[model samples]
Target: MEVNEMAAEECKAVLEHASLGRLGCSYENQPYVVPIHFAYDGGYLYVFSTSGQKVKWMRANPKVCVQTDEAQNQSEWISVIVNGQYEELPGPQYTAERKHASSLLAKRSHWWLSALGERQMRVGDKLIEPLFFRIRIHSMSGLRFTDEKERRG
Candidate 1:
């Protein structure tokens, strides 16, 4: 297999097409990672989530990493990594931005279910208020791997 570095445009394309990724955050030297559903727009990756461990960790340390990939097989794959800072979108000052995030995320069917469902499971019969946040992309890099046969073809 041959591996090639993806250009900025190619990386953006991957982020635009992918809705799921692993979000990595660190607090006090301990690292945590979890699967997240996100929408990439402009220079940020928007996410809808409940107040939980991740939220607390991110609040303490805004630095984060997001990784997503598309794999056809062992010999063919595209992977992207985004390094960014987290920004919470709260009401009052961020009303407009929150609306924009909501619109973009709504395009993905059942986008809110997983977040809400997880929150419900954690706090049974309790009111679940979802929070919106965005990862301000600082940099992105990606790699594409293609089998030698495919490249030659």
Candidate 2:
């Protein structure tokens, strides 16, 4: 088996094809990681979630990281890591950006349904509110693992 560093374009390609990623945030030296569904454009990743621990932590420290990976088998895999800054798109000031995010996310059927359903079950309220946020990707890197014999000299 051999592991190789993926080029910038390769990393972006993986992000483009991926909709789910693990978001990592830190506050006061403590780390919290959560799985999130997101839409990737050129330099940003749009995400939706309710007001929770992750949000609180992100609000305090905008620095964040996102990880996404795909595996065909035990030995064949690609993993991407993105370091970014968190920015929440909210209210009237960010209407356009919010709409853009909604439009991109809408491409995936029922993207918002599960979040609302989870909120309803947890809060027992019919009026469910979810926030939209975007991560401003600063840099990204990736690694690919494969059988060495598959590549020719």
Candidate 3:
């Protein structure tokens, strides 16, 4: 198998079509990672989530990493890693940005359901306020792996 570095455009293409990623955050030297659904637009990755451990951790440390990938098999795969800062979109102050995120996320069916449902299950009927945030991408890198034989074929 051979691994090649993906260009910026190629990385962006993956993000555009990817709906799921792993979000990594650190607080006080402790690292935490979680799976999330996101939308990519205009150099940012938008996410809808509930107030939880990740929110608290990210609030303390804005620096984060997001990883997404597609694998066809052991010898073929594409993976992307993004290093960014987290920015929360709150009402009144970020009304416009929030609306934009909502619209972009709406393209995926039930995009908001996972976050809300998980919170509901944990809180037990209490009002679950959804939170919107975006990861301001600072840098991204990607790799593409292919089997040598497949490349020749």
Candidate 4:
């Protein structure tokens, strides 16, 4: 098996095609990671979430990492890691962008269910408002592994 580094365009393609990733954030030397559904647009990854531990941590420390991948087999796989800064889009100033995010996310069915469900389970209230946030991509790197059979035909 041989592994290769993916170029910038390839990395963008991977990110564009992927909707799910592990969002990692750290604060006070503790790191937290969770699965997130996102929409890649322009230079940001728009995400939806309820006010939770990850949000609080990210608010304190903007630096974050997101890892996404596609795998066919052990040797046929691609993984991308992105370094970015978190920016929460909330309130009047970000009305347009927030709406845009809503539209993009609406493309996927049940997009709002997970967060709202979690909120309901925790607070036992359905009044919990959803939050929209974006990650401004600073850099990305990807690795792909290919075996002899894949490399041949």
> How many residue pairs clash (N, CA or C atoms closer than 3 angstroms) in each of the candidate models, in the order given?
0, 0, 0, 0
Instruction: Give RMSD to native, each candidate.
Output: 2.6, 3.1, 2.4, 2.7
* Superposed model 2: Cα runs more than 4 Å off: 109-112, 125-128, 148-153
Superposed on all Cα atoms, model 3 deviates from the true structure by an RMSD in Å of 2.4
Cα displacement (angstroms), candidate 1, residue 40, comes to 0.5
Model 3: weakest 10-residue lDDT segment is 108-117
lDDT agreement of model 3 with the native: 0.90
Candidate 4, residues 20-81, lDDT tens digits: the string is 89999999999999998888889899998877789999999999999999998766999999
Candidate 4 residue pairs in backbone clash: none
Query: Relative to the unseen true structure, what is the C-alpha lDDT of residue 130 in candidate 4, on a scale of 0 to 100?
Result: 69
Task: Give candidate 4's whole-model lDDT.
Answer: 0.87
* Candidate 1, poorest ten consecutive residues by summed lDDT: 106-115
Please give the TM-score that candidate 1 achieves against the real structure: 0.89
Give the per-residue lDDT of model 1 (tens digit) for 1-153.
Answer: 788999999999999989989999999999999998899999999998877889999999999999999998777899999999999999799999988888888787264656587668877844456789999999999999999787456
lDDT of each: 0.90, 0.87, 0.90, 0.87
Instruction: Please give the lDDT score at residue 96 for candidate 1.
Output: 94
Model 1: per-residue Cα lDDT at residue 51: 78
Per-residue accuracy of model 3 over 1-153 as CA lDDT, tens digit each: 788999999999999999899999999999999998899999999998878889999999999999999998777999999999999998698999988888888786373566577768887854456789999999999999999787566
Candidate 1: stretches off by over 4 Å = 109-111, 114-128, 150-153
